[model samples]
Target chain A: MQKISPLRSSIEAFNKFKAARLNKADKAQKTNQQSQTNPFGITFKGTVIQMDVFEKAEKVNENTQKAISLKEKMQNTGKLLASAWVGTINKFSSLKTNAIAFGNKIKDSTIAAAKKIRDFGNTKVEFDVFKYNVSRLQNKPVSELRTMLSNELQGVTNE
Target chain B: MNNKRVKNIIEALGKHKDEESIEVLNELGTNCPIDEIREMTSKALIRKNTHRALELMIVNKGKGINDLSARVAMCAINELLALKDKQEAIKILDDTINMHSEKEVQDTARSVKALMSFSS
Candidate 1:
């Protein structure tokens, strides 16, 4: 069996400690090299992530703009459509009122023409309806005159 | 469940729309990876009585699947639009445009687009 010596044990422990320290130092140096030497890779990666984030933000902004613009257009169009309907109704109402006035004027003219005909019926007027009727129906039946003639003839017969 | 019962349940889930239908459609979109099932999901989305179906169609459009029948449904929906639904309808029309094969469908889409533009 080998006997353990204190000096040897202490020396061994010191060597183990140095090895761990060397390993940690090497790791840190490697990390520093990665950070310092390859600037383009880091910049490329950062640029890519930044651009991706920007693209996503741009899309969100676009969608928001679309929603806002669409809403505005809808509101405006709705108002315009309402105005058009109101205007159409107003136009139709005016047209109807004008038509009614024209109709009343025509009816008044027609009645006046007929009154003139009745008043100047016996006169030689061009538009006298009574004279025109008597002229046209001259050969048609005259029941009242026939009755009068029959009554006179009956009187004669009785006499 | 047997295949027949499972299919009936899935179809029922598709037809009777609710949260359950959304869940089933999602499941069908992901797990049940058959062309026919996918097509059925697309068709069901076309028939769904809500805008969720259109949203699903948009997702499928992003995934590069073409659903032609949905285009016809979109045309049918175009006739019922007020001004408020123009944007959504335009988007649906845009997505549906790529799926059409017949000229009549294209003409219908063009006319609807023209009408929307005129209204605008």
Candidate 2:
């Protein structure tokens, strides 16, 4: 007799979530690579402004590169924030982060990422769990995104 | 989770809140579970029949009103404050303060007065 596993179900769900996220990341990276690769000299604010313009864009823009630039830069920010909070989110997988209730399996292992994810929590979760992936990624993080941008400005100044 | 309890709260909003009724009704619009009671309470006060709202507050006597909790109280108080009827809020709040004892509820009443003063 075959027995169904709830634990397996959650794990499968989690795995599927991870794969989709990575696939989105791949598409974003491909677009940016296709656009223009900035070898360590990318201005964070420039990317932020571009993303802001892309976000406010209701339809396709005259410049597809601008859209991809925003999407790619945002992916970079997401990874950096997640690295900061990996600790707490991994510790408490059972508890749902109020900020990002559905999207982003917020374990205790990651705080900064989860918080950033939560800052955009309203848009972070999958609408149909697989139907529409990363659509909400367009909302953008105003605060952390600004901070990352300001730091990039500092880097530019020193250069 | 409990729809049945919710219906009862809507019904209570229609009636008077006695000691026994307020205790049970207080549990409706909070972490316990959200229900139409929140919507109904706000709606009932909007009619602005100050005479009736005050009557219910006094009749209930503040026994289990704390079970009604702070947020609901604050919401209702804000409505009353909007109508610029401090007497009604003051009457209910002071009555609740004298009869019942909860720091949150007390603070809400105090804040309402502060807010009203600031506006004036």
| Candidate number of the best lDDT | 1
Q: Model 1: per-residue lDDT, tens digit, B1-120?
A: 123323333344445524445545554432343444445455444445355555454434222122345443343334324435556656765655666655555555556566767776
Cα error, candidate 1, residue A9 (Å): 99
lDDT for each of the candidates? 0.53, 0.48
lDDT, candidate 1, A123-143, per-residue tens: 765643442233232332333
Fnat per candidate: 0.00, 0.00
> Which lDDT tens digits does candidate 2 get at residues A1-159?
988799999999999999999999999887677445444434665552233433555776658979898999999899988976885676566565544664554554477777787889677564443321222211333332234323433343354
- Model 2 whole-model lDDT (C-alpha atoms): 0.48
State the number of backbone clashes in model 2. 21
Strongest candidate by TM-score: 2
Supply DockQ values for each candidate: 0.00, 0.01
Candidate 2 CAPRI classification by DockQ:
incorrect
Point out where model 1 deviates above 4 Å.
A1-159, B1-3, B61-91, B94-120
Runs in model 2 with CA error above 4 Å?
A1-159, B1-33, B55-74
